[model samples]
Target: MAGKLDRFEKLINSLSTWLNWVAGVGLVTMLALIVADIIGAKLFKWPIPGGIEMVGFLGVVVATFAIAQTQFLHGHIEVEFVVTKLPKTAQKVISCLTYSLGMALFALLSWQSFEFGRTLQTSGEVSMTQEIPFYPLAYSMGFCCIVVFLVLLVQCIMTMIRAKK
Candidate 1:
């Protein structure tokens, strides 16, 4: 059981690392697009018609995709003073509870987002300017949220297990 859990933890960490790299690439691409748009508008008196909309879409993608990586890296801010003061066992229990709640919340969010995306896709929704489909982006965000929740849950479980030892 312990070995299995250890493997799970390693898998989660590795997956998160890969996701983070993809997120980094998305961010870089977004930056490049923005710069190109600006240069085109300023120097050439030409603007990308859907540039703003596309960037917004990509921004959502970048942010959502990076969430799991951020949580895995312990990059989320928390007021740990109270938690730190507790006994080791108590802290582990609290951590478990916290992560459980996080999982529930994220699960709910992901479900809702997916439902919304499905509805949008069914209706063929489109943006105001570029007429870009909104469902794909929403779906991606929902998926990322799910992934983040799973990673956090795994981390919490691992922490609890180690605390027992």
Candidate 2:
């Protein structure tokens, strides 16, 4: 069981790493688009059509896609000052509980995001300027949330095992 969980953790970690790379690329693409738009507007008196819309889409992609990687890296802000004061057993229990709650929250987020994405797809929702479909980005957000949820679930399980020992 531990081995299986470890394998799953590794798989998710790899996916998170790949997603992080994608986020980086998205950020760079967004930056380039904005710069080009600015230059075109100032020098040529012509701005890139839908440039703002594209940057908005890329911003969503970059922000949502990096969540799993950020969680895996423990890069999220955490105030551990109070936790540090707890006894060993109490701390372990609290850690497990916290991870479990996090998993639940992310699970709900993923489910709702997926539902919203489906609605967007069925409604043919799109960005006004670019007509960019919103479903794909929403689905990506859902995917990232689920990945982060799984990561947290694994952490909760590990913490439980450690507490047992």
Candidate 3:
């Protein structure tokens, strides 16, 4: 059982890392697009079409896609100033509880995102400038949220095992 969990953890970690890379690429692309748009507008008196809309979409991608890996790295801010002072058992209990809450929150977000994506798809919603379908971006948000939820679930289970020991 432990071995299986370990394997699963590794798999999730790898996926998170890959997603992080994708986020990095998205960030860079967004930056380039902004710069190019500015240069075109200033120098050539012609701005990139749909540039603002693309940036907005890329912003969402960069933000949502990076969260899972951040969770996996335990990189999110935490007020451990108080938690660290607790006894070992209490600390483990708190960790478990924290991860449990995170899992729940992200699970809800994931479900809602997917539902919103489906609604967008059914309604044929699209972006104003590019006319790009909104559903794919919504679906991607849902995917990222699920990844974060899984990361939290693994942390919660690990904390439980430690508490048991």
**Candidates in descending TM-score order:** 3, 2, 1
Q: Which stretches of candidate 1 lie over 4 Å from their true place?
A: none
Clashing pairs in 1: none
Task: Tell me the spans in candidate 3 whose CA falls farther than 4 Å from its real position.
Answer: none
lDDT per residue as tens, model 3, 1-165: 999999999999999999999999999999999999999999999999999999999999999999999999889999999989999998998898899889889999999999999999999999998999999999999999999999999988988987888
Which candidate's TM-score is highest? 3
Candidate 1 worst ten-residue window by lDDT: 8-17
Per-residue CA lDDT of model 1 for 45-78, tens digit only, reads: 9978889988888888788888888998889997
Decide which is better by lDDT, 1 or 3: 3
Best by lDDT: 3
User: Candidate 2: misplaced stretches above 4 Å?
Assistant: none
Clashes of each: 0, 0, 0
Predicted structure 2: lDDT: 0.92
